[model samples]
Target: MKEVFLSTRDFPVDEKFGLVSQILRSAYSVPSNIAEGSGRSTNKEFARFLDIALGSAFELETQLILASDIGYLSENKLQEIQTLLQEIQKMIYSFKMNL
Candidate 1:
């Protein structure tokens, strides 16, 4: 998520509050949901939170693709982020499955 913020630092001022904001929110949601879900009392509740996190990961993935298409991110960078997001989603899914 820090990478997302840093990458958006050079975005146009107009986009600062647009694509940049969307990317940040979605990226932040992934880990934030995980942490929140971990604090829940039941595995079922935690799994629900993981589901939300997965959704956020998918959202982030889409935004990153948009960012790349719009030239805000380089293809290589997008690939890197996509790889990480996939890994995170897979880990979250595995955990949720165990629950």
Candidate 2:
């Protein structure tokens, strides 16, 4: 998430309310959902939040691709973040399944 914010710092100022905003919101959503879920009363409830986090992860993935397509991110940086996001997605999925 910090990496994302750092990377986006170089984005066009005009995008502050556009791609940048969407990217930041979705990026924040992933862990925010997980943390929110952790406080739930039941595994079922937590799993649901995990599902939402997974969706946000996927959304973040797409937004990152779009950012790359627009040349806001370099291929190397995109790959680095994508790999990390995928791992997080898998971890979330596995944890949700176990629940």
CA-lDDT, candidates in order: 0.89, 0.94
lDDT, model 2, position 25: 97
Report how far residue 72 has shifted in candidate 2, in Å: 0.7
- Candidate 2 lDDT, 16-80, residue by residue in tens: 99999999999999999999999999999999999999999999999999999999999899999
Considering only N, C-alpha and C atoms within 3 Å, which residue pairs clash in candidate 2? none
lDDT of 1 by residue, 16-70 (tens): 7899899899989999999999999999899999999999999999998998999
RMSD to the hidden true structure, all candidates: 1.0, 0.7
Q: Once model 2 is optimally superposed onto the true structure by TM-score, how far is the C-alpha of residue 77 displaced, in angstroms?
A: 0.5
Backbone clash total, candidate 1: 0
lDDT of 1 at 83: 87
Estimate the TM-score for candidate 2. Answer: 0.97
Task: Give the Å shift of residue 27 in candidate 2.
Answer: 0.8
